[model samples]
Structures are given as C-alpha cells and as structure tokens.
Target chain A: MSQCLHQVAGPVWNLGRLNHVAIAVPDLGKAAAFYKDVLGAQVSEAVPLPEHGVSVVFVDLGNTKVELLHPLGKDSPIAGFLQKNKAGGMHHICIEVDNIKAALMDLKNKRIRSLSDEAKIGAHGKPVVFLHPKDCGGVLVELEEA
Target chain B: MSQCLHQVAGPVWNLGRLNHVAIAVPDLGKAAAFYKDVLGAQVSEAVPLPEHGVSVVFVDLGNTKVELLHPLGKDSPIAGFLQKNKAGGMHHICIEVDNIKAALMDLKNKRIRSLSDEAKIGAHGKPVVFLHPKDCGGVLVELEEA
Candidate 1:
C-alpha cells in the first residue's frame, strides 16, 4: 500500500545520513578536551561563529560527529538553554536531506513547522532549517542540504 | 608534543563509531510515526525490553540510528525523564569502544565516573557502561563494546 502510494505520488525529498548531534556545554575547552583527551576522538579546534552566537568544536566519531556548542555572544541562541540546563545538555540533531526546499515544503504540507520560513546558511555553510521541537517530539531537528 | 605523549602512554582503548542516539518519548507509536511517516526514515517495529524497562524502535538513518525509547514496566529508567520532559527528548548517546574494560579502566583513572562500577549487557546485547552525565558535560554517554 505504502509502495503503491509512493509510486503514485512520489516523495518530494529524501532523508540522508545523520549529520551531527549538537551538545551545548558551559565550558567549551573542557568539553573539547573530554572528547579529544578523555574519549580519544579526533576533535577539531573550537571555531567561533559570532554571527551564529556560538563557538563550535566538532568531535569526529568516524561515521558521524558530536558538535560541542558554547555561547559566543550576549544574545546567544543557546544562552537560555544553558541557563535551564546549567551543566549543558544535548541540544539538537542535524540530519542531511537531499533537497532542503522540497523537504521544507513537504514537511510544511505534513504540518511540520520550521523555525524559519526558509532555509538559512547553517554553521557548516549549508542551507539548513530547524523544525519546531513541539512538532518533533520535543527534539529540535535540523535538516541540512546534503 | 601530543604525538610524543601518545607514544609514551599509548591510549588504552579506541573510540569507534557512534552507535545510536536514544530519545525518550512518552508515546512510542507517535514518535515512531514522526520518524517514519513524517521524516520518511526507515523505522523498526517497537521491541519491548521488560528487563531494560523500555520499548525501543530503531529509526535507521543510514550512518547511525535514533533509538526511540518509551517506558515499559513500572521501574522504567526513562519514566522520570519523560515526566520531566512531557513532550519527550533526547536521552543518551551510545558510542562504540574497541575495548570496554580498558575504556572503563582508563576513564576511571581519569576521574570519569560510570553510573555503575562495571559494564552491563545493554539492550543490544552488548557490554555497555554509562558514564556520569556531570562528568560528560551533562550528556549521558553510553560506551558499548564494539
């Protein structure tokens, strides 16, 4: 039944690999060290994205990544999250999509609300949009163009 | 200097791929549908683990998986997390390790406390140990034997 429906109305977009799981941390250096020295994963140097209001360090896990994020400015997006979760916590999960616009449109038609009306350049310099957590089982999901 | 130190101290264990990210959900069916019907991902049937006190549905994302967990029995570990986050949320991330015992020993030596003194048989039937969230930047990290 599903296959027949798919053949008839063909899916608009395709979901790709799991990009990275974002973690918000109060201490960026300690978090980076935890992945690099403690867990012994290859970690990238902390890259400050002032415009994005966060400093990110990518912890390479071979197949995927763990992005450690820290507040970079006064009005950082993750500031309130850090305030609520004092010690910091898992922030969001980014998943790759073949077509952001198609995915957004399809998701919108499915009543899945995006945080923004259109895709924006994400930290990875790819077009991305965050789906509302309320509609995603309280999980902030980022769909990035693959 | 780090390379020289690595040669001198040789890391005890190696961190492998990220196995899966676990999300605790209040409603198993709805969460499963969100990933399957909404996001169009390959989802598995919910498997009840009475001993583990949770029902799990694997959302295969190609590279890794999203384990959607719902409280099973009365003593479900995720029951409290669900109570706190009514809409459901990301619970823990499981990362594979080359040597579980060695990883636990090394982490213990580094003052990285595990929730239990020893590794236990996890839901996937692998030896797994959960590290203290406080020590892991408030992220509950599960180290599974690869």
Candidate 2:
C-alpha cells in the first residue's frame, strides 16, 4: 500500500548502512578463534548480558559485524536457536540505520512484524528493534540506529 | 585431530564459497519490493537454477546478497526448506572460502561427515558444496569461494 507512496513508506532499512550479522555459537571462544585466525575479522569486546542470558563477542568486519554468542544458561535464546538449529550459528543479522524508528515503521508498512513493537535499548544502550523471524525468512534481524 | 586446523571439529563440509543465501517467499515481486524499492538494495537479476530445483531473484545487499527463491516445481529445494522450516526463514547461510579440497581434508581428518564429498558448479558458474543438516544442526549451509 505504502510502496505506491514511495519514500513516504515509513523508513527504509537504511539498507546501505547494514553493519553486521550475528551468529549463535555454542562455544564463543572457539568461534572467535575461527573468525579471527581463519576469517581475519577483528574482535572488539565480549560482555555478558545477564538480562539476555548470554555472553557475546563482537567481531568487526569493516562496515558490518559478526556477533558470536554463547548461552549462559539452559533457557537462553541462543540455546533455543542452537537446539533447533543444531551446529550453533547465526542468530540474527543487524543492519545499521540513522533513524531506527523510521526504519521500523517502514518494515511494519511492508507487513513485517517486529520482535519488539517499538525500538528499545540494546546491549550497548543503543536504540534497536528486532524484526520477527517469521517476516525475515527464518532469521532474526535487528535494526540499530547508526 | 585437526579441529585446530579446520576449526569446526565435528564434521567436514567441502564448502567452496558462499553460493548465495536463499530467502523463500510466497510472492517474489512483493519481497523484491521490500528488499529493493524499500531498502534501496538492487535486484540484480532473476533466473531459474533448475538443476538446484528453484527459481531465484538475486537481491544484492552490498557485502552480501539476498536470494529470493521460488519453487519452480512442487517438492523442490525451496519447497522442502519451507516445509521443514516453516514460517521463520533462514534457509541456509553460505560461507565463501578458498580451497574446498583442503577444507574437506581437514574435516575428514577430524572424522566429520559431509553432505557430499565433492563440489558442483551452479548458477553463476561458481562451485558449491552443501553440509548435511544432521552434521550442521538444522541449517543446510553452502560453502564456496569468495
């Protein structure tokens, strides 16, 4: 419906600003070693987000990032993804945008459901919104304002 | 024995380069609308890779590419992925690397089974290798060269 309105459609994903794709790994250090020694990506930091129940390591890939996550407990999101997914990998892809709210509204206009109805503060205290995997084709996609 | 070498110790996947990440959709034009018209990503081309048993539209997402695949025939790869995975969508995440041969060698050295022992060319004349879901969790990852 809004596509007819063109730029009037809420906000684009700011596609060009997409930063990194996150993968859920069973062993964070192991994945870090693989991505670093093998892929040569840079590792920035590893902070345990207890509220989320996991330890995360951020690997920088220039314009994008690869987040390797290890579940802290049995009921963690990464654990659920690993059990259903198997060999532990990609959790969600994060795309960077200047305006998170506008971008979220755009996804909504496209009939895509957000994991969070509104943009919320993420790990780094940055505003973020997660698109439902149902709408993203089996991948949890996070939109963060750059 | 060489998990340190190949990295992942459990299985061997003679992955070549990332072939492309396939995104299944009920409507190609609508999906393309979100990826292209909305996100500003380009729809480079659309073609049917009958050998792989799916029709695909390549949506270029800068560093990566989003492939919108429609089932050409019933019970095709796209259809099967949809059937098993259902609503939530990551079909498979492909990784592009050098030396598929050496990669497989490292896998075998670690007693890991592969979906296939070899590589086959597909779509854009690039070689592809698939890892058995049993070994790679539920995800069917494709490996090729960058």
> How high is the CA lDDT of each candidate model?
0.94, 0.66
lDDT of model 1, residue A140: 100
DockQ of every predicted complex: 0.87, 0.25
lDDT of 1 by residue, A16-80 (tens): 99999999999999999999999999999999999899999999999999999999989999999
Model 2 lDDT on a 0 to 1 scale: 0.66
Give lDDT for model 1: 0.94
True contacts kept of each: 0.93, 0.29
Error of 2 at A119 (Å): 1.9
Off by over 4 Å in 1: A1-11, B1-11
Q: How close is chain B to the truth by TM-score, in each candidate?
A: 0.92, 0.76
Task: Identify the runs in model 2 with alpha carbons over 4 angstroms from their true place.
Answer: A1-13, A26-46, A59-64, A73-89, A109-111, B1-20, B133-138
Question: Model 2 - which docking category?
Answer: acceptable
Report the Cα lDDT for residue B143, model 1: 96
Model 2 Cα lDDT, one tens digit per residue, A70-123: 888658867877887556755776766778877777766767899778998877
